[model samples]
Target: MGKLLENHSKNLLREAGVLVPKHVVARSPEEAAEKAAELGFPVVLKALVPVGKRGKAGAVKFAQNAQEAFELTRELLAMTVRHFPVEKVLIEEKIAIAQEWYLAITIDKKAQTPLIIASLKGGVDVEELSQSAPEQIMTKSIDPILGFAEFQAKELWSELGLTGKPLTLATQALTCLVKIFLAKDATLLEINPLVLTENGDVAAAASVMSVDDSAMYRHPELAAMVQLGSERTWRPLTDLEKRMVEVNELDPYRGTARYTEMDGGEIGFLCGGGGGSLLSFDALVSFGGRPANYSEVGGNPPERKVLGITKGILAKPGVKGLFVAHNITNNTQVDVLAQGVVQALKEMGKDPKIFPVVVREAGVNDEAAREIFTKTGVEYYGDNATITEAAQRMVERIKALEISGEGI
Candidate 1:
């Protein structure tokens, strides 16, 4: 998933002919004040972060004048909502809302189709509203092959008690929004408090959007706006994590390499595939091992990719040991994986003897893998040793090092 900040999402919505409040992005308190003065008074100030629920986090505020805007922007800039530091403020002219509505488009994974959700009530939590007053909300599923039509959008709003001009304008807005959602290959496009102005005009007051990262190749223009690989993390990517992204992207199509640094740990973890990585992590933790990072190396990756990710895993501060494991594989070459792991250890001067490296790789070319690992004094295990047993061995080695006063 690639989540776009509010400013970027609003820009896309505006370009699609949707009515949105005039907005400007300000990097500093002074800039915010200046923009607020220029755009006229009574503006909304929101921290420009990819995560949601900014209002609940106190990252959203209102200002009636330049002085208020400056002070409020300063406060917003000092906030870290959901672990993401606020670096920019989105300042927009506050619309006079007569009514607040909600609208959202997303994929229903179980059904494997596009889903549209709308409600006459807005400016409140949609989940809470659904539980309290389910009758007010409407949901429609669109066929991927057939697509959504303007008539469908009209019927949706009309059922929610919209009539006359508001009904027509709301229909048009929904139609445009659906088009943008499908064209951009978005996973989610949400408009909370889709407002009806005091003057009886329909407009989108706020938006949150995320596009599918796998479909990114078709949308080069969005490359700069979307924060790729953000879905896997709650906080902003650490410097080491960013380096790993570059490594994985080096050979995007050949295989998959993923790395995520943990808060603090002593063991550097390198596992294969998603399911295997999770099971290995759980097994290690269950055996009193603290892994410094979570990583997956699989899909017959080249030695270079493996080497790059392994180096990153070990480079994290406080990583004193390494643990490598994989399930029985039919495609991934264990010999090639061994070459990368051994090379990375040599490059980092991490001796398996004192540093505690354990390997439990099996299948394709396991015989060659075993020879390579054992040559480096690594505790190598083939299919005979289960992942759980390998994890227990790794923890035991770390314990032995601690007892001997020869810790890495």
Candidate 2:
């Protein structure tokens, strides 16, 4: 799942014939004021970060005039919302509201079906809506094979007690939204306050969307909007994370290397084999070791790809030790993994012994990998040491290094 920023999702909605407020993205306060002036008075200024609950964080503000837009834009740009430094703000033409409603189309993962959730109770968070008045909210499941139909959309809004022009417009808007959701392979497409303007027109006042990354290959148009692997971080990708993305993309067909930074840790985690990495992380945490980052490198990556990821793993601040382990390989070559790790350590001028580097990889070419690791003065283990045992050894090595304060 990859979340699309508000501006991006709104633009997609507009393109699909769903009404949305006229908006522009401003990178600075001056730009915001200019855009506000161009869009007319009474504007909304929102911090353009990837996380939700911006209103709760005071990241969403209203500006009655150009001067207010300038001040609010400055305030928003200066704040960090949910760890993401605000670099841009969304300026929109504020609508005069008659009523606020809610509509969202998403995949029902549990039932493997498409789900539509709508509520007449709007201007409130969906969670709050569900909690406060569950009856006011309507939940409908669409058959994957049959799909959502025009009549189905109309019936949903009508059943919710919407009638006259609002009912017809809501039906059309939701139908379009559902089309957009399915067309884009979106995991979620939600309009928080599907507003009924004073003019009796429905507008998607807000949109929060996430698309399936596995289906991204089909959406070349969305490439620039979505940063792959964004689900791992609710906010923007850090510089290190970006580089790891590049390394992973370097040979898209061969292997995968995913990196995510964590707060306040010392051990540099380097592991792979998907499920194996999770277990490795658990083992490390179980042994009271704090890993600075989580990384998975696997699928028979070449030495350079492996080396690139290794360099990134060790580059995080406070990474005083390194722990590398993986499941017994099916196809990934241990010799290649060893070569890459050794090459990275050598290039980074790291002495494995004092720096606390540990590896517990096994399978095809294990003999070669073991020889290379030993020759490089790096602690080595094959299937002989369970992944858990390897993590224990890594913890002890880091402790020993802390006590000695000398390179091996």
Candidate 3:
């Protein structure tokens, strides 16, 4: 899933014949003021980040005039919402709301079909609505093969106490939304506070959308809007994380290498397999060791791919030691992994003896791996040491260096 910025999601809704507020992107406070002026008085300004809950974070503000817009935009720009910086602001015309509603379409993976969830009680968290007034919410599952019908949408809104023109317009908007969801391969399409204006017109005041990355080849126009690999992280990608993404893309077909940097730690972490990586990380933490980054490299990756990820792990600011561990493998060549680690350490001018590099790899050509690692002065373990034991050794090695006053 690649989450689109709010400006992009609203544009999608607008193109689908669903009414959306006129909006523009402004990168600076001055630009925001200009955009607010163009959109007319009482404009809304929202941070252009991919995360949610902007209003709670003070990333959403209102401006009665251009001066207010400039100051508010400056405040939003200086703040970081949910770890994502507000590099740009979305300026839109404020709508006169008579009532608020919610509509969201997403897949129910267990049922393997599309699920529609809507509520008349909007402008509040859906979880709160579910807890406070369960009956106010309505849910319907649509058949993937047959598709959702307009009559079904109409019936849904009509049952929720909508009888007049607002009901009819909402039905049409929902029908269009479902069509857009299927056509665009969207994983989630949500319009919170889907407003019924004072003029008795239905419009999407805000939207949140994400599309399937696997199906991205079909939608070239969304390439600029969607941030790849964003679903894996909660916030914006760090510079090192972006570099790792590029490294993985360099050899897309051969193997996999994924990396994520932690907030602050001293030991570098590298492991093979998802389950093994989690296990290793837990083991490290349980033994009073802090890992600087998390990485998974497997599927018999070539040496260069392994090399790239290893170098990235070691390049973090506070990383003082290296820990490499993997589960017993059938296809992955331990010797090849050993070579990559050795080359990375050499190129980075790191001495394994003083750097506290520990390895616990076992399987396929273990003898060659042991020789390679031992020759380079790395503490290597084959089947003799458990993953837990390897982690403890890594922690002890770092402690020893610190006590000896030879810390790197």
The whole-model C-alpha lDDT of candidate 2 against the native structure comes to: 0.88
Whole-model alpha-carbon lDDT for candidate 3: 0.89
Candidate 2 structure quality by residue, lDDT tens digits, 1-408: 678899999999999999999999999989999999999989999998877778999999999888999999999989998888899999999999999998888878799888999999887888987888899999899887788898998899999999999999999999899888889999888898999999989999988898986566689899899845556666667888888877877766787777888887889998988889999999999998999999888789999999999999888877888888988888899999999999998888788766778899988899999999989888999988899999999988877777887533
lDDT of each: 0.91, 0.88, 0.89
lDDT of 1 by residue, 1-408 (tens): 779998899999999999999999999999999999999889999999998888998889999999999999999999888888899999999989999999999999899888999998998889999899999999999878989999999999999999999999999999999999999999999999899999999999999999987677789899999876545676788899889878887666777788888889999999986788899999999999999988988788899999999999989988889999998877899999999999999999998877889999999999999999999999999989999999999999888877888757
TM-score of 3: 0.85
Give the runs in model 1 whose Cα sits over 4 Å from its true position. 228-230
Question: Which pairs clash inside model 3?
Answer: none
Better of 1 and 3 by lDDT: 1
Q: What total of clashing residue pairs does each candidate reach?
A: 0, 0, 0
> Which residue pairs show collisions in model 1?
none
Give the CA lDDT, 0 to 100, for residue 119 in model 2. 93
RMSD of candidate 3 to the truth, in angstroms, is 3.2
The alpha-carbon root-mean-square deviation between model 2 and the true structure, to one decimal in Å, is: 3.1
